[model samples]
Target: DALYVGNALSYRAMAYMDLARMFEFKRTGVAYLDEEAANRGIYGLTVPIVTENTTERESRDNPRAPFYKMYRFIMDDLNLAEACLSDAHAVSAKTDASIGVVYGLKARLWLDMGSRFERYVDDLNTMISHEADEDLNDYDKIGITTANECFARAAEYARKAINEGYSPLSESQWFDPSIGFNTPNNSWLWANIISTNDIAATTGEWQSFVSFQCVEANWGIAVYQDEINYAHGWMIDARLFDKIDEGDWRKTTWIDPEDAGASNAFITKYSRGTNLSYNEWRNYRSYVGIKYHPANGERNTSTIGNAVSIPLMRIEEMFLIEAEATAHTSGVGAGKQLLESFMNTYRMSAGESYTCKAADMEAFTDELFKQKRVEFWGEGIVYWDYRRLELPIERGYPGSNHARQYRFNSYPEHVAPWTNFYIPDRERDLNKGVILNPDPSQAIPLWEGGN
Candidate 1:
């Protein structure tokens, strides 16, 4: 019971921290919003970590607290959970806090805390210590970075988790549209199902917007409507699609207008097959991908749309994280070598090979970042890295159609405006503690280890 409560609280703390990172200015205890840059109707602002009053309203109305206070709240919840949970790897699923899950969550939280990210090295080691197979690289290079003096221990923990039978799917497996949404694979670690008989069960969508993101054409039509509006209009940014090489299996994730039989069109893994009527498929053109479980498909009945599982965390992420950690802590050579090995094993190419190398460490870091963005595009992991690094994204890059209205072009260079959201006026009026972020366009430096 204590473990359960602690885990739940940990989740709440994470959600709060996520919002703060998104909306709050790094140096100031406020969300970024210059009066000249204000936009309305956004809420879900950051909360105070230190509490003087226990009442709901006071907490809601209070201004954003110091970073230390917020970090304390996050740590307290996670620490308590760790104390309550056993290290026996009990309850892999939902019955109780599995030791592995706790460790993984702590590692992620510590990384977010920046100064404490190295703490993950320890938790990862704890998890790795329990592995049945001591050989971290024995099974196709799935978990942890390459073994070396700096990251060997962390690699051990990663190897243990990978030994638990998690890995990335082969390119051919990913290319198969049928059974794409099926679960209990060699790769996926944690997953949750989108049940039918729920709002997310609507034929054209899932609760997480997978249907919206990965589906297009008649395949994505409303479960009830044989033909209707496009589902939610979500898609991969065109510039992101450009990064994939022609020979790479992931290139199938998007389609060029010419190949798609029209301008701005492409094929995606969202379909069960290319067996659809030409007219039916034309509507989708180039706007679909696989992560959204579109292959789970539209149903004849609205009562139950696509029944599919969402991959919450995959070992692939750990692989990438290890590569990055190795690069930063161990050195570029160790990081590069580990990343290259992983790519050669899992992300091999048919026509085009993956390429990223740098003469300088900073340039090498850039290469690593590029690989990460490509590898985890639809998985929803890259944006946080951009925020943490204060990296600028080029929405106006060649082949991009990102709308200008949502972009902040006030400064010398244009900036992505969607990076931060605004706090609704109601938040300021109703909650005395709220302050609107004036400029969501400009990047905020890391609160720690940055000037």
Candidate 2:
């Protein structure tokens, strides 16, 4: 019962954190507008907060909370979880909310809260800062005031997770047929396990089975066997692919652009019995990822192939957060040292040395972001980080391979306002006080800068 409650609280806190990131002011994507909104208290809304103490009637009338209140609510849940979580479970039990998971979550939360410290810090406007509860008063000690304090807390919590003895997966384990991403390992702090009996597996309709491109499952036959000309397989942007160094093992995660013919193993293996023409069986798609394959190296045509666990939190993420937080809290040199240490320990090959050439904090963070994108591709993590960093989506460059409809640049100055979700009509209907976000769903034109 104790473990269950702790796990529930941890998951709840994660959900709230997602809400805070997703629904914060759209204006914050731009620097000048962000400062203006922070000063005027305009567009600082996030999703509504609900707790066990709240009645259903109260929920029906609840308005979206201010961003600061939502941040506080998430922190409260994490604090409760930290107090309640058990250290009995080993890190290998990746589905459980172990102490490492709590610490990692704290690190992630503090890193995010630190990014926009001006808005997250409580002031006299709403005045929810001084609750009579002693636990609420403990916020200062937990590092919730200045940006430096928040980063320090992030680094501290991340180190706590690292000290739990969890290490990154080795290269041999990266695409191991026996262990292939489907099973939980010691490297993960938390994961969502999909059992053979689960509907996702039983139906063989999960995105990982059909959309991962390299898996020989479901609609995947269209790509591997050339049974049909389904051109909608997941692929990486050409610009991003070009940026990856050839020496980096991660660059091989995708199909090499030079190996477009029947020489590719996927086409040769599956096209043996098919009546595919010479050109039909060839893999024409560029930069499609092959990192995630069916379990046991078996074709995912069967139900068993669909049984895979998705990692929610990994030990490597804690390392990244720690390094980034340290860079901001201390200096670029300290942060760069940690980055190099991490690479040498986990990512580098024998006799290979890694160095950080970033001279300033911005350059250091840019390098860190690139490393993270390559490391965690197809894991649904880069999106949050990109949003947090206010990076422009530049897919409209020359020689780009992105789909025609999506090939547009979305700079912060122009505003990709649809990045923030609108409140659903059903939700607004249920909660009368809820205000819907402005719709920004129009098609964006390709940016023509420097053309």
Candidate 3:
């Protein structure tokens, strides 16, 4: 029973973590939506907090939880998980939650919570009255009242996970067609491993084809070669690609124009000997990703290609988190040192060292985030970071690689509110208390700049 309860709590904590990031207000001080949603009074509501203890009647009438309360529940779930779980629990695989995974989530949650500090305080005052369970509702016990405090906890937890002996992958292991991201390595803290019998395998639409360089699959970038079928293939923004230094090992993950030799060789090496013509391969954009190949370097449309492992958490992220949190709690210089150390050790090519050119905190944070974006490309991690930081999305510029229709800038201030998902209509219809987020969906203005 304790084992089941511990696992259930871990899952609940994970789900709540996602919900908090996905639904929390971008900025409580400022409305994320246009004036229309604020006028409609549905601007900043988050998802309803439905805990395991919430009764059916209560669930049907639950109000959207504020940022503080939502996080309170999430922390409580993790706390319960830590208590319920065995210290010696044997975690043979990266898929299962371990003490290190719990620490990783704590680090992530603290950093994310600290990202929207103004909103957290404002929402805390508004929702502080409504209470239920004493143990979970006592926000005072959480001990994080300010962004700096949250950052301290984030660094502390991240350090704990780092002490668990996991290290970042080396250059040779980073894009190894056989073992690179498609399989779990020492760096992975948690992952989702697809097996032959899994639906993702049976359906043959797993991330290996959708986002990875699995040319053997019928879909993804390979769809362009034959011209008979089409599926949306993911690509990197030219602007982001340009930021990657030539010496950085990650530069080879995508089709780099400057490294035409390596790029062409990769296309041929992983092409399953399809021998697509130059024009055929060039039919698609040049910056197509080639990072995630199938397990064991499998090159076919069979289930083997679909049975790829994807990391959900990695030691590399913890290093980033610790660096970021240290910047906030300590000084930018100290954090910059941590970042430079991490990059020099794990990211740079042999004999190359990294240095931070940022003179201040803002520039330093931006530099760190840029490094993270490049490090975790195609990993579905940067979007949440963008949301948390409210960083502008600038997909439109000269020579941009974004699809023509998607080439637009959401910049100079906050990330586009449209990036925040709207509460589902089905949920709204069923629960009277389920307040909705402002529908920020609309055709954005296209950039007039040439691509």
Off by over 4 Å in 3: 27-32, 40-44, 86-90, 118-140, 204-213, 216-224, 229-233, 260-284
TM-score of 3: 0.88
Give stretches of model 2 more than 4 Å off. Answer: 28-42, 89-92, 118-143, 204-214, 218-222, 262-284, 413-415, 447-451
Q: Give the number of the best model, judged by lDDT.
A: 3
For each candidate, the alpha-carbon lDDT, in order, equals: 0.51, 0.70, 0.71
Q: Model 3, range 342-378, lDDT digits (tens) per residue? A: 9888898887778889988889989999989888878
- Span of 10 residues, lowest total lDDT, candidate 3: 268-277
Candidate 1 per-residue C-alpha lDDT over 1-451 given as tens digits, one digit per residue, 9 for 90 to 100: 6666655654555566676666644222223443233343223224555433358767666776434344445556655665665453444553233444455555454445432233235534533443334432222211332123324444434544455446687875565544453343556655655566545655434333444444432334321133455533445666666655565566565544455544233233324333334454455545344433343444233333355565655677667666765666568887788777777778767544555566556777577777677667666677676655556665443344555433322222222345566667777776787667655434433222211
TM-score of each: 0.69, 0.85, 0.88
Model 1 TM-score relative to the real fold: 0.69
Writing each residue's lDDT as its tens digit, candidate 2 over 1-451 gives 7777888989998888888777665652445545654664547688888878879899899888876666667777788788887563464467778888889998988887676663434442333444333744633323344777778989999999989888898876775655556678878889988777878767745354534534334444435544454644567777677877655655656656776554565454323322234464355466766566555544635567667777898888988999999999889999999998988788876777788899998899888988898888878787778767777677777777776666667775333555766668898899987777655455456555432
Error of 3 at 325 (Å): 0.5
Better of 2 and 3 by TM-score: 3
User: Where's the lowest-lDDT run of ten residues in candidate 2?
Assistant: 268-277
- Candidate 2's displacement at residue 388, Å, is 1.4
- Alpha-carbon RMSD of each model: 10.3, 4.7, 3.7
